[model samples]
Target: MAGTNVLFTVIVILIYNAYTIDSISTANLEASLDEYINAGLKCHTKNPGLALAIVKDGKVILTKGYGVRDLSTNSPVTDRTIFGIASMSKAFASTLLVKLLAKHSNMSIYTDIAKILPNFKFTTHIRTDNANIRDLLSHTMGFPAHNLMRLDPKLTRDDIASRSQQVHSIHPFRDSYLYNNLMYGLASVVAERIGGKRWEDLIEEELYTPLGMSGSSFMTKVDLSGNVAKGYGTDDATGGPVPIDFAINRRWGQMGGSTNIMSNAVDISKWMLFHLSKGRNQAGQQILSENDMATLHRRRNTITAPTSEKYFSQPQVPVSSLEENYALGWKNGVYRGYKVLRHTGTTWGYSSLVTLIPDMNLGFFTTMTGDDPGYKFRYLLHNYIGDLLLGETPWLNKTTLCSFPEPWYNQSTSVYHPINKHINPTRSLNYYVGVYHNSMYGNLHVTMNTSANTLQMNYGIGSWLLYPKGTHDKFVGEGTNIVHKIIDLSSIQFHSSNLHGRSTIDSVKVISFETRAPPVFTKTSSHVNTGNIVG
Candidate 1:
């Protein structure tokens, strides 16, 4: 009896020891996830309008909302709040393309886009007779990143497709991966043609619905019924949050293959799980085939050069690397010793980042409804979460790196001014009234169209307008800060030059303008008795 009692005591002790070890392990994991959340919140406090989520092994280890959804009303953010995932929509849309390929075994990414859109052509640009569909997905078709398309608010996917034919490639096809949103917009058109439905509808039917992402939608104008994070932008002058109201248009929405999708962290976690499972849903339904999944995550291009001189300071290889490899919609690279698959999205007001470390089965999604200030919070959170997952201490400074000095979290009261309202008067109809000459662009004529109240500066196939800024000078029609204050007419100084024909007064050059001269003889020749012909 004494020996049997001693045996029972030994068994109880072993079981208790096992239970304690399991408890410690669970606690450690929870602590790690907590540290990530705390670091994310700290970053959010600095930028005030960010939503973040972290997932590991198909489970949302940490998900939290920080700051207010609407800075104006001071409404707190919630887990279910919707955010514009921006270009992350491309990842989702790309997943649908992969799924379609899996369902139809014969479909190929290498298939000529012209197969779906017969009128599609790259015959005009790069001397190429045609471009492949993969070029559009990989962003190597050589179209300009973005141009006049943004100005035409009515541009559609088909319009973008037709315009792509006129785009000139700087290099041969597949020579380099040049990120182009316009090209992606054109790709969406191909998807529409092949799927026989809108890109949004395809995503809903195949990806979102199957994955049970009920809160996910491709709608730009989000329904206000549930918690919705209002989009914000930093005022260029004041460095404060400015609320932006964007209208949902088909052109923008169909750009879903590139940007334009709204989702909550909860729904996005499901997306992470789907990717982690290699395109399998929660119910074990294979949403995409293994081959398609492999193709989407494969390295398609090699980084031959730094993305920019500034990017050299960072350790990760730029998306410019790899060749013939396509990773569906995600750009695959290594960052900070980890295999990173990431993409960034931006609209006028919102910014989003989605990063996945496939080797570790870890994924992160961060959404900021505001501008650059908000993105600072995102970077901090991303790094901190990464550190926690790797069992390292979080390291991020609280100070903002914004160009301006101001409270990073403060909201801006600056009003939005229309492009027409800010035009300078001197540059309106009178400044460009005379003829001008340039060494490179050649002879030019500035005409004032009084009926239109616009100054037309004609050059080649393109023309720019100098709208009135104040009473003295005009502002360029399409100028961001990067291209702003180009050719300040207020500083123009008149000088006489004898080199060109008779002595003609020339305006002093302020900012460099690159444009060709208008046609010399639009109207018939008029010869005057002064021995001068003005046509």
Candidate 2:
């Protein structure tokens, strides 16, 4: 939520080594790909399963799977093996939205969200009130990533819509990209409001059914067919891959259009073909206009991270660096000088990377199971494939990427004190027990855990055990689990304010809620239902 997910700052830009299109024989292409991929699986990626699908010149060129689907079963991954593609599902949301817009003359991409869903609002900061569908699609809606909002129990699309008013807009409207998942869910809320249909049903009718993506469905239900791949993550203690629980374990039902779409390479190939053919159906009719498709694919928002010209101190890979920008669903940019649109997604135990070169009518979709925190394997293979197809010698490989150290995102950060474990609280635990509420964030409960003789913070996202930090009133939360894996739970600082006449702890700040501006929940009351606290 704070910075780039998986990106590498190459040392220097390389010259485009343009070779003849026929330089690599067609017969050798598949063999070469298999050899390279198999080597990658063995060398550094170490994924349990991976599926790849490629579309070119309006045809499905390749559908292949390698390795076992899960470590427990030893069942080999097939071309049809199902894997969860996380945020890549965003493209489907935006595409379905565009198709819906085609039927409704009253609604357009430029329409303000408030017009479609009257109750929807964003922080009353008038600057953010006028945000339209395009802003949501492109993630330029001004709100920084408020991921914790999605953790509410049995949250509906309406709840997400209602909560937008609470989250402050920290970024510029329609200028900088914020990459918000909740905003996408809020956009889907708008879609359902105007289309008079659930976002799931709308996509199934307009996109999936027509594209013949029979195996693709929302992640809420488990496929009884017994073909689903298990999710994974690396264990911090062992630094080895571990089988993580499903999204269901953490209430995936609350996720609307933001994420959780289960699909196989076969179904996703049809999806790729839809974009490659400019939204044409099998019947040779346009589902969406070429201009609309272009608009969806065109770069609308600029961002830092991989898109910005920044250098990190490390041994680097030689890649062609070019200016890049974010489009609606995909990151519209260049890979080795080829105009490209791409996106990568990672969930509990699955990761996916997709690339599309519209000029060449080429698209690549690769998804894998197991832990890939840095996603180096996916990026390495994406660039390698781009090199092979572009007729240039491949420069990216496992040795170059895997050699770098994986980032440690657990530690909390602050300029004054990263953490002062030596600090201790001066007051009794009972004084801190209360309900702190942020208008946009709703409420967080702090209650006495008499059994443990400690303070427990109850939020929709996590149940944190609070302990003193040496001498300061500020305490740190120990969170072993979270709504989503990536959220970093940090210091919980209690502020003293005047109540009647004497000073008391009146507000508590969750320092990790937002990196730039932490959500300070005021003490609404010291009374709360301890039974309502959940993990």
Candidate 3:
């Protein structure tokens, strides 16, 4: 029975695609949107659910939901269902900054971040004073992305900001672009300091309340009272989606500006319409000045073909023909002869995309329960809509550009068959069990799980058990923080031997790796000796 349904869905999708190519009327487009989205979602049959909204010419043309909210109950998702929009929250942060600037009058995007975050520091050689609000919005902060540090539930925004000096930069100040979550978090901190309110409350007061986006908020768990969709993650080995716990509220309090807002398609449509109307409320009152809105949309950084290829590989737009640029909090480029601005967000099991075409006055919002595959589905939906609206050829396919967490966990591990058997550690697990610290990220306590004969490293609020990677001294593991326990696992790699060639019995060297960044840690003067330790 399931097989028959799958075949039927495929056939329907093909027919709809053919119709969409020929259709030109807005009525026709609206009529086929449900089928179009359903067809795109067929590739992610195991995903828990999804909700989408399309806004055109200052009004919502379509808002719908697909699949079940949860696998166990089979509860269908509705237009009102809430899901974490992840980095989509960045635009909200950007908007808040613009709004604050309008009120302050004296402030500008060029205002030095030091004015807001007095304690922010950079490495000695770098000109920390040159850093300003614009750098944070355009992601030209010059520092590498250090997302792992932001995953700690215990660390406040101030804690992360104070340690900025500890994070090394790959590019010289304002010379290149690096997508950064910490910078966005810092932007919110600046807003809090200026607006005299929590980031969440400021958003509510300045934007959500006025726009009537009652369904949207930074409170992930509190949003559950509504019809919220359960998030799911794709298993790298099996390519199957499974339920992931929604622990977003715990860690998002401080990082809310980067990836914490929760909202439904219905509410997000209002946001889209607001942007389409150029930041005016329904009453025609200017909520944000037109000049400020334009500032938010102004291209601040140019993204070359190489960076696009490096970040989002296949299924992405050919970087050679089109130029991509980053604005304050949005990504803009030309698509099918129309000016396009879009951004994608991933938080644990949920993924989101918001695209705006100012020329056509069209906007799209999509949210789904899965990781990388969900991203694929989003791009598919965006392309399909774009093709129909722009009267272009159906260009996006299964191979569309998709992104996953760093240290991408794929099926590569399964390819190497065991030669003999798993190798054990050189010394007892206790030798690795110690508190290692990094100035920027704080302490990661490695403890011996005697019962399991394994070593577990705890970073702030989450912990993961380590296992031999290729060698016993070098270990690799995957786990999430205590807060959002979303199935999208953060990976970690550990090394015990001194890569620096300086190790003592009481103070062994340790290296910790997470996704794209690596931080080295050395044992403290004291060590916890478990009886299991052996030379």
Candidate 4:
């Protein structure tokens, strides 16, 4: 018996030694990733925080948090700390659509959207007649991010989709690729119609519970408590981020199925793992058939060539970098000879990224709370990880950081636009104070701030102070708006003292304004007159 015991002990020691050696190799790989991620994040000292998770072989292998989640409490971010995942929510909606399509043999990904939602007719039909569920998911329906409609929580998904007719398509349907949120909202309405429930309810029942993503939520019942990270924005002048308030945060609920999903890295890893498993839930249930999975992952629309000379003039990713296309809910591209699936989401104070390399059996999820004007750090970190995992050369270094665009406002220029600092208002500030209306967007109310001596403008989920730009009827405004982008307007004008002007982003005019009668608030006055006010 004693001899047998000694032999057993020896065998255990041998097994332990072998496991230790293997763990040592794994630890080195993890350490490399840690250093690489931290180094990439070091440049953004103003960033409120970040949470990251990496999955391999259907398991979470690396999970971490960096920086402060709340500056006031100096709390560190944790795996469970929630951040607004923004457009990443689209994948969940897409997955749900796939599930619904499978359950209802009558429906198909190629089913025309107009057939599903007859009410979703555009004012001037272009190729909308040919639009389908796949078109909405792939963003080939010919509309550029018309995000202004996503600011009013009061607007239902149907109301938002109805306004799609009011906006013109920048490209012919299926002729050009343009990112759109309204299309996703329209898709959700179609999903609701097919599923006989609210889009959020369908998502919660079909995706969240099945995947065990307890930390995820749609438009309602957001749990920002218990380790949830607060959203924040930066001021280039102060060189730090300030906590965002309800005025801007409210838009998260109004984005419909487009961008409103709040989740943490811990739960998000499950989502990545599900995709890595080719659309199988942990319970061994095939959430989507292999064919449907193929449909979801297959490239449905070829996007602009990344290497086209037209893109060379200030392109986000080099065309030669990767031949890319839009898969159902993922951006499909080639990275270092591997099929790369990825998506990015941005809100006013948070940014998120999810990447999957199915060939390597690896997946990654990261979310950051920052006001990065270009939101490049998320991608930089993503690229560095992809390079490291693929065993490529260290192409990203301190110098690589120089390629990122500067924050919209930087130290050299004034951060907070001082009221009338650059140019004084030619007329009294009160001249610009009035109610502006657009049929698509509910209202914009401008009022004279007596204390600040600036004209304050309030619209769906945002408020900004307009300062004179030294031009008659033209004013400049600078601030972050509700849809999570910076507002740098130079042509905000008041033609005929009625506050008529246009606001643009990326050189595309997205919103127009004009004076209208204020909301009549009389006692017992119901239906105080509303009309289709063309913006």
Candidate 5:
């Protein structure tokens, strides 16, 4: 028996040696992944909770969960934990659309959306004449971001379409890319019409079931069971995790194309494999044809701009390049000499990123339940993994990890005109009357009536309360703590007044005052004005 025990110990030692050797062979890769994990932990100070995965050659080299999944319960995150992957849903939706197109040669991306959903009508302007399947996927249909519908928990897709009539087009049909969710919802409608199935059902049938992505599904009104990560935000002062109230109404689930995807990294990795293999499954199932895959990767335009600083230095992969605009749903670009195809998603409490490097047969998926700070964590992880893959320094230097420079504020030199300035002043008197313009925010016109002492300032969108600061100057009532003053004309030097307290008003510029327009008074009698109000 003693001899047998000694023999067993020897065998265990041999197995351990083999495992050690294997890990050593992949030392650089492991080291790089470790560096990323460290960086991710540091990001929790700002971003809080993060989960990351790195894949190379169809194998997962790293899958890590950093920070807390539920700060209240002190539950840690795991590889199998689920997260809401906001706009990343677009990638999956686009993939399924492409797959359906491949299966039915009769269907093309250029097919008119109107043909699929005849009831679909635009009150503002119809760009559907040139809009095709490709336009929706590429975000080239001239639809302004219609987020109002999503924000309203009570609104449905039908209601959103009804309200869309009130929305105006930013440009003519197919003129430029305007990232809009309305078009995506319309695309989902097309998918349902063509596939004779709901968007979620079609995804399960075409992609999830075949790839064995069992942990992924569309978010519904029901509570997500075990393995789901709760979303968290940080307190501005304490840097502690604060639970964000996420509205998971059924109506929200209907928004499948733009948001509503819930997935785990383990399951998401399989989805990445589908892209890395260029539309094929692990078992040699042809999920998408070569031509169809190529079409998905092809540049639809020439408008590649880094969405953020973290994306700037990374290498681009072959599936897409930023030189050309839209490659299916992926943003194509070059980072560090390699072609890169990537996209990011955000809901109120969740942020997600997906990136693929086709040349290296590598892909990555990261999801976290947090807000703006989480974005920093995502970028840091991506940069670390990317540098490691490119055989660069495995760790990010201090300078490299610094925040990207803020974009320059472009001054609009267009002539300013009041939307409503021809109206008369009414009773309910006021002491406020002046021309207020922040160099940064442009002009604000204020008028006060006889009875009321309340001050009103008309800027873009609508009127805001101008709290009395002194004799002639008032500070913005809203955000007063951040913006201390919104001066009345009397408080400023005759030359010019700063806009938003940032940009300097040009003293030399001649002031051309327009007549005040009538006020469309609300129910509250804070200030009354007699003028013809034009919106």
Candidate 6:
């Protein structure tokens, strides 16, 4: 009886000590936040809204929202204000697939994609399913970003999974990192086949419910209703960010596991704490062992593609960062002496950053409505919080990093010319009109508007005016609709193939549709021939 009483006293004392420690940590963070957070967010006054959550030593130090949720209503954002988290949703999918794999213990991570997924047909130099879940999650599958597949707004997960057979290789198989979202979406498709549940439900049941993220979901405005923040995009002409249509939110929901989790900072703080823990739920049940967690965070592919160099450049990267890698749904790197697991997510107008330092038990999540700030603001805020917690001096005074992110972006995106300017087509508009097709990307139907005397592309995408370039066959696409800032319009060149002494456009080269080598769509039907096409 005496021993039992002593044990109860000890447990009480331990709980008190933990409470005291958390309180102290919270006080310190609150005291430092006013100056740090306000200064860091000074430049984004024009932005619609944003939310942030910071976790340290398995405690939520802060969860805050800044600015208005909607421009017209002027409703201030709160910790619980829902926002689209974009690719940060990847980690949840990764965990779900891992859990599903554990349930089916016989299945290996190295199990061929063909054998695991139902009728998997991701074609490559090797066998169709030679690449496994690891390759898809790590993004070393050699396929470029066939992002056009997601634009249709009608394709299902099953449709996406089957269409993978059509996308050809741009990089060497298992030899390069390409950051393919479609492949990750396919991973969820694999999970569904093995687990007998839809990707949405599996994530809700397995990850969100376990983590106490009750407010998270695949939001389409209809899901969250009143609480969702409107997304915003930058307009170069207006020189300020504008609120994007709320209807655009529904498009990503159908795109599978790549990016469709809408959540709040308050709930995400719980997610940060979960990672800081030993993969145990609030009920103390072990969902993932330490080894399982390590596997999820394990470094797999090094990110070193030439176009990827912009990520490693200065001012934007964390201080003392040494190398970067792609793990299962996470970017693995070391910033200073602490290990960093991070990912930046941009879903149309919304953008987010999820950073975790497991060894230090520190992480931060930032979600914003506007695309103007991009990676710069998120990077600055995380570094500021990390510096405050680590007892380190501000390397560039924090606000300095946040002040002028525009110049850095200008330097990064200077590779391509602005699409605002257009040159006249080399021949008549009818000569360039055709029904172009790529088995992987589907179809692109080009038609001429006789009234306007301009050619239009009906790639199942928005209305794109084909503005000629270089006084020749080359042309640039300009989206007529303002909301589709996600689509590229920089370069589309027409190639002529002569047959029977007549010149006809046989192919349309897409230079900037998130494609690596910029794939070419062969002309299957021509407007000049009317009924007959090149085929």
TM-score of each: 0.70, 0.85, 0.83, 0.80, 0.68, 0.86
TM-score for candidate 5, please give it. Answer: 0.68
Candidate 5 or 1, higher TM-score: 1
What does each candidate score in C-alpha RMSD? Answer: 10.7, 7.7, 9.4, 9.5, 12.9, 6.2
Model 1: per-residue Cα lDDT over 52-148, one tens digit each: 6777766776666766788668888776788877777777767777666555556677766776677566745432445666667776664445432
Q: What residue runs in model 1 are displaced by over 4 Å at the alpha carbon?
A: 1-46, 125-130, 248-251, 303-326, 373-376, 397-474, 477-535
Q: How would you encode candidate 3's per-residue C-alpha lDDT over 1-535 as one tens digit per residue?
A: 9999999999996676545444566677776666666655665565568888888767777888888787778899888888888888888999999999888877999988877677667774444778888988888867767666655554676666666656777776778878888778778888888899888888999998999888776643355555777778655556677676555344664675888688899989988887878888766778998888999989999775422233334333432113388887788866666788788877777888888888667888888887753254566577667776656665543334221222232423334232222557656666667766676666667777666567766665556666655553666544534422232233344444454695432332233344445666656623544332211
Ranking of all predicted structures according to TM-score, beginning with the best and ending with the worst: 6, 2, 3, 4, 1, 5
Better of 1 and 6 by lDDT: 6
List candidate 6 stretches off by more than 4 Å.
Answer: 1-28, 125-129, 219-224, 246-249, 305-318, 372-374, 404-422, 450-452, 482-486, 527-535
Sliding window of 10 residues with minimal summed lDDT for model 1: 514-523
Comparison by lDDT, 2 against 4, better one: 2
TM-score (C-alpha) between model 6 and the true structure: 0.86
CA lDDT, candidate 4, residue 148? 47
Q: Candidates 1 and 2: which is better by TM-score?
A: 2
Tell me, by TM-score, which candidate is best.
Answer: 6
Candidate 4's TM-score:
0.80
The parts of candidate 4 lying over 4 Å away from their true place are 1-24, 126-128, 305-323, 397-422, 428-431, 478-488, 497-535
Tens digits of per-residue lDDT for model 6, 352-414: 888888876778888878874336666666666666666566454544655443434443442
For model 5, what is the error of residue 497's alpha carbon versus the real structure, in angstroms, after optimal superposition?
Answer: 28
Candidate 3 wrongly placed segments (more than 4 Å): 1-27, 304-323, 393-421, 470-472, 478-517, 525-535
